[model samples]
Target chain A: MIHQTSLMAIAIFLFFASTVIGISFYLGRKAKSASGYFAAGGGIHWAVNGVAFAGDYLSAASFLGICGMIAFFGYDGFLYSIGYLAGWIVALFIIAEPLKRMGRFTFADALDSKFNSRGIKLAAAISTLVVSCFYLIPQMVGAGALVQPLLGFPHYVGVIIVGLIVTLIVTTAGMVSTTWVQFIKGGLLVILCTIITIMLLVRGISTAPTDANGKASYIAKRGVTTVELQSMGTVVEPDGAWIGKKDPVTGDMKPAPYVRIKNAAGVVSVWRKDVVKFKDGNPDVTTFSETQATYTVNGKKNVNGLPRGKGEGEADLKPVGYLSKLPNGEKETGSQTPWGFLSTMQKSEAILWANEKIKDAAGVETTVYYQKPTLGSDFMTPGSSPTFKKVREEKFFGKLDFLSLMLALFCGTASLPHILIRYYTVKDQASARKSTVVGIGVIGLFYVLTLFLGLGAMTSGALDVSDSNMSAPLLARSMSEFLFAVISAVAFTTVLGTVSGLIMAASGAVAHDLASNVFKFKLDDFQKVKVAKMAAVCVGILAIGLGILFSKMNVNFLVGWAFNIAASANLPALVMLLFWKRTTKQGITAAITVGMISSLAWILLSAQAYKDVYGWDPATAIVPFSQPAIVTIPLGFLVLVLVSLFTPKPKDLAAVEKAS
Target chain B: MAGLDFKGSGEREKEDAGVVAHNTKLGVWLFLVYVLVYGGFIALAAFRPDVMKQPLILGINVAVVYGFTLIVSALAIALVYMKTCRK
Candidate 1:
C-alpha cells in the first residue's frame, strides 16, 4: 500500500532513527575488544540491562504483530502476548543466573563450559545460528511492512534499508550498541503506546456519518456496500434517499440494464448491478456510492494519494471497528475505562471486516472487504483464526497443536540464543537475576497495554482489511497522522532492535563458537572482533532477503514457529546439562542435532508450510499438524537421557566440579 | 584426583554444591507451579473452551482473566525466586 508521506511523520522518524545511530557511534569505541563486542564487557548496569531485555524480547512480533492480530481477530491475538510473557517464568526462575555463571560470551559458551567438547561447541553453535536466523525473518519482514506506510516506498526497499542500518548498528559496536538501542526502543515503545491508548479511551466510540465530508466517517456510515452505480436516464432522489432512479423530464421510470455517467469533475460512476423494481420497497433505503477513475500524473500511473490495499479505487475504505449495535440498543458507548472498554466490547456488536478474493473477467485478482457483524462475546472467544480454531473446538489435533505450541513458547524464552546472551552482558549472577526481574516487570506491563491497543484498533474506524500488520499503525493514523508516523517509526525501530540482537547471536556463533572453538582457529581478541563484524554483515544480508520473501506472513505467527524450533533444539541440552549429572557431551550434541533437524523437517513438511510455502494442498502434508514442539521437545529430552546413559562420563565434568 | 571434588575439596566447594542443589530444587518446584498454571490454561483452552468463554466478572470471560493471571503469576514467581535465592 502506498501511503501519502506526512512531513511531521518524516521529521519525527528521522529524529528517533538518528539518535539511535548516534548512540551506536559513541558506543563503538568501547566494543573494540572481543568480550565487549559480544557481551558488552559484562559491565552494564543490571537495571539498564533489564530494560534492554524487554527491548530485545518484545521485537516486532509483540508490538506490530500482536496489536495487528488483536485488531483483526479480537482476543485470539492477546493469547500470544500471554504465552510470550509466561515464558519468562522459565527464564527468570530457571535459566538466568545459572546461564550467567556458566557462559563468557555466547550460548554455546555455556553449553560447552561443562565438558569443553568440540562436538558440543559445533552442535550448539549451529543451533544458535539456525534459531537466530529463524527469529530474524519476522523482524526483517516487519521492517519491510512498515516502509510502505511510513516512507511511501516498496516493501523490498524497506527491507534493504533496515538490513543496512542494522548491519551498521551491529558491526560497529555489537552488544553494547544493541543493548542501548533496545533499552531506548523498549522504553519509548511502552510509553508512547500507553499515551496513544489513553487517547483512544478519551476519544471514545461514536456513530459513523457523524461528519459527511470526512472519508472515514462516510465509509463507516455506508458499511461495506460502497459500489458505484449509473442509471440509463436521469436519476431522481425520492424521500431524501442516497440512491434514486427517475426521469426528470417525463417523471417516468427509465430503468436500464447498465449505464455509465461521466461527470465534468473527471469522475466516472458505473452502476453495474441490476436495478431493483419497487414493490412497496422503502424509498429511504440507500446503497453505497462509488466514484471510479484510473488516476494518472505526468503520463505515469500515480499510486500516491490513492487508497491502497483492497477496494481502493471503487470504495472509500473507512476506519472500521465500531459498534454496529450496542447492548440495550444504544447506538454508541461514550468514554470507557480500561476495564470498561473490554467489558463493553465483549457485550456490544462490532462491524469486523473480512476480505474475499475475487478474480475479474481479465483474471486480475482483487480483494473485496465485507462487513461481518460479530457479537462482542464471540469475538473474545478462541478459534476465530485457523491457528486456534481446532483448539477452540476441542478437537484432538487442535488440542495437540495448541498444547505443542504452548509448550514451545514456555521453554523457548529461556533457550533463545539472543535472550540467553543477555545474561552474559550483566556483571554477575545476582545482577542477572535482578535484571531478569526488571525485564519481566516492564514486559508484563507493555503486554497488558497491547490488549487495549489492539481492541482500540479493532474499533478505530481505520482498518486496512487486507493487511493485518498495518492495524496498529493505521489505528494510530486514525487518532492523528503525526502520532501514526511516530508510532510507525518506533515500530520500525522495534524490528531493528530485535534483528540486531539476532544478528549478534548469529555472528557470535560463527566467530566464537564455530571458528574459534570448533574449527580451532585460535584467534586473538582483535581478530575475533574482525571476524564477528564480517559475520554480522553476511547475516544481515541473509535476513533482508528472507524478510522480503516472507513479507505477507503475520510476524507473530512466524515467531511461533521459531519458538518451537528453539525450544526443541536448545532447551533440553541447556536444562539437562544444569540438572542431570549423567548428561554427557555426546548426549548434548546428539540432543541438539536431532532436535534441530527433526523440528526443521517437521515444520517444512507441515500443513501450513504446504499451503504457504509450497502452494500445495494442506491435506497432502505428511505431518499431522503444524506445531512440532509437542513431539520434538520431549524427543530432545529423551534422546539426551538415553544417550547419556550409554556414553562414558567426561573427565572435564569432574575437573570443573572440583574447580567450582 | 587433582583435589577438585565438590564433595571432597573444601568447605567452599561444599557450599557451592549445596547452593547449586538448592537452586535446582527450587527451580524444579517453581517449574511445577508454572506447569500447573500455564499448562492448565492450555489444557482448559483445548478441552474446555466453553468453560473459558463463560463470563467471570464485569463482562470479562474466564479466558481473559486467566491470561492476565498468568502474567501476574509469572512476576510473583520471579520475585519469590529472587528473594529465595538471596536468602
Candidate 2:
C-alpha cells in the first residue's frame, strides 16, 4: 500500500512530542532524589495516577492491535478486551492495597519485604527485567506500525524515533513526567476514540462506503469475459480475466480463483476470478475481479509494480472492509444506538478479506487477497480469526490454548512490574485502591468503545489488507485527515507513555534491586538515580532492537505472550509471599526462577515461536501448546509450596511475632 | 510544587491491622466471585461456543453480551469493593 506523507500528521506529531519533552524538562527539577525519580515521590494524585494507569496499561496492543484484530476477525478481538478488564479485578481485590503497603521502588521491594533475602531480590529483579523486556516488544512493534502510515517512514525508523524520545523522557525526569504524559495521552486516547465511535454511529454502516473524495472505496463487480486457452502450458485472456487451467495429471479443467497473467507489456500480475449466478440462468458465467495487490519480495525489500507514494501517477491500496449486504437489503443504516449498532451488524453481511500465497510452475510467488462475504452471526462469533479459531475445533488442546491465554491475561495485569510500581506513585494503600478503581472505570469504558472502533473500521473501506495494526488510525483517516492526524499523534503518545513506564520499571530493578540490595553497593540515593538513568538508556536501546526484529507479528498476540510470562513468573511468588505464612525466601526465589525459565523455555519451543520468529516448521516445536500459563502458573504454585515446606522458618519470625 | 510534595494527606490515615484484615477478607470474596464469572465465560467460549453463538438478550448473541458484561461487571465490582472495603 502506498502512503503519503501528511503535513498535518507530522505537525500534530511534533506538537505532541514537544509537549511531552517539555513536561519532562519542567518536572525534572523536582525529581532529583531517588524517590522522586523512581516513584514520583509518592505524590501523584489518586485521580491523575489512575488515568496514568490507563495510559500505562493501554499500550499499542490495546489501541492498534485490538482494533486491528476486531477489524479483521470481528468478535474475537473483543476477547482480549474482556480478559484485560477482568485482570484488573485481581489487581483491585488482591494485589493493589497489600502491594502498596510493601513495595517502595519496584516489584522486588514488595517480594523481598518479608524475608529481606538477597536471593529473593535477585530472582524478582531478573523476573522484572525479563517481563518488562517481553512487554516492551509489542509497544515498540506498535510504534513502528504507527510510523509507517502517520510519518511515512520505514518501520525501523519509527521504532528508533520512539526509542530515542522515550529514553530521553525516562532519563530526564522518571515517573513524575511519565505519569503526567500517561495521564494526558490516556485521556486523549479515550476521548478521541469516543468521538470516532460517535461519528461511526452517526455515519452508520453502509453497503458501499465512499472515501473522503466521494469515490467508491471498495470494488465489487460481475461481468462475463472471454478467455483463450494457450497450447504452451499457459492461459490467456484478452482483458486479463481469470481463466481455468488444465490439470497436468488428470487433464481436466479446474477453476482457479487467482490466475497469473503476463500483460501486453510483459509485466506479470495476478487477477481474481468470481463465478456469479444470475436469476436469468446465465450458463455458469464467470467474471473478472480486481486483486488487491501482487506483492513481490526480493531479499529484504518489498517491491510492488504499483506506485509507492502519492505522486502524479501513484495509487493507494484499494480501501476495503465494506458490508456486502445490509439488513433488509438497505443500502445503509442512517444512524444507530450502541445496541442498535450490534443488532444491525447481526443481520448484515460483511465483505472480509482473506489472503492466499500462490506459486506458479515458474516459481514466481504472488499473494492474492480475496474478499469473503460472511454472515453477521459468524462475523460476531469468536472463531473468525486463525488465532482464536482453535476454540471452535474439536481437539481439546485447541480449546486449551484459548483458555490458557484468557487465564494469563486475567492474572498478568497485577503482576506486571510497570503496573505494580504505579502503586508506589500514590501515597498510601487507600490511594492505591482508589486509583485502581478509577483505572478500572476508565479502562473499561475504553475497551467497550473498542468494539465500535473495530467494527467501524471493519466496514470503513479504508483498511490496508496487508497491515492490520494500522486499522484504527486508518479508520480515522477514512473519516477525515485532521482526525487521523490527531489520532495518530495520540497513538504515538500512547506508545510513549507505556514504554517510558516499562523503562522506569526496568531501570529501577537494575539500580535498586540488583545493584543496591543484592550486590550490596554503597551508592547513595543520588548515585542510584544516575545509575538508573544509564540503565534506562540501555533497556531503551534493547527494546528498539527487539521491536524491529519482531515486526511481523500482531501486537496483541505478542502482548499475550508477555502476559503469560509475567503471570507465570511473578504472580506465584508475589501472591504466596503475601498470603501464605510458611512462604520462605528460598521458596519465593525458587518459584520465580522456575516460573521464569519454564515459561520462557516453553515459549521458545512453542509452535508460534518456531513459525513466526525462527521461520521453522511449526510441527517441529516440542511444546504441545503455545500458551504456557495454564501449565506454568500451576507449576509455580506447586514449586513454591514444596520448597517452603522443606525450608526452615525465617530467622526474623520471632522478632516479627514479638513486634505484633 | 504541590505535586512534588511526597508526603500528602493520604498518608495521615493508615489502616489498622483489623481494618486491613477486614479489607483483605472482603477483597478475596469479591475476587472469587469475579473468577467464577470469568471462568464461565472462558469455558463457554472454549468448550460450548455453540452456546456463545446463540442470542440470549436483545438480539445480540451470547458471546458479545457475555463479553460486554464481563467488562462492565469488572467496573461494577471495583466500585463495590471501593465502597465496601475499609481503605
- Per-model interface RMSD values are 8.5, 2.4
Per-residue lDDT of candidate 2, residues B4-82 (tens digit):
3343332334558899999999999999999999989988888888898887787899989999999989989888988
A424 Cα displacement, candidate 2 (Å): 0.3
Q: Give candidate 2's error at residue A387 in angstroms.
A: 0.3
For model 1, the stretches where C-alpha displacement exceeds 4 angstroms are A209-216, A219-316, A360-362, A552-554, A658-660, B1-15
Which digits, one per residue and each the tens of the lDDT, describe model 2 over residues A1-660? Answer: 666678898899899999989888878877898989998878788999899999999998899889999998899998999989899999999999888887788989888877778999999999999999989999999899889878989999999999999999999999988988899899999999999999989988888888766777866443425353121124444222133456767998766676555555444444566777788877777656556556555542232345444565444556688888887889989988999999888888888888876555555555677777789899798888988898899999778888889899999999999999999998888789999999999999999999999999999999888888889988898889899989989998899999999999999999999999999999998999999999999999999999999888767768888899999999998888878988998999999999999999999999999998889989889999999999999999999999999999776666863664
- Give me the candidate number with maximum lDDT: 2
Model 2 stretches astray by more than 4 angstroms: A222-256, A262-269, A272-289, A297-316, A651-654, A657-660, B1-13
In model 2, residue pairs whose N, Cα or C atoms come closer than 3 Å (at least 3 residues apart or on different chains), thus clashing, are none
**Chain B: TM-scores of all predictions:** 0.77, 0.84
- Summed over model 1, clashes come to 8
Q: Model 1, A399-516: lDDT tens per residue? A: 7887788788888998899999988887777778889999999999899889888888887777666577788888788777778878888888888888889999999999999889
lDDT of 2 at B86: 72
* The candidate that achieves the highest DockQ relative to the unseen native structure: 2
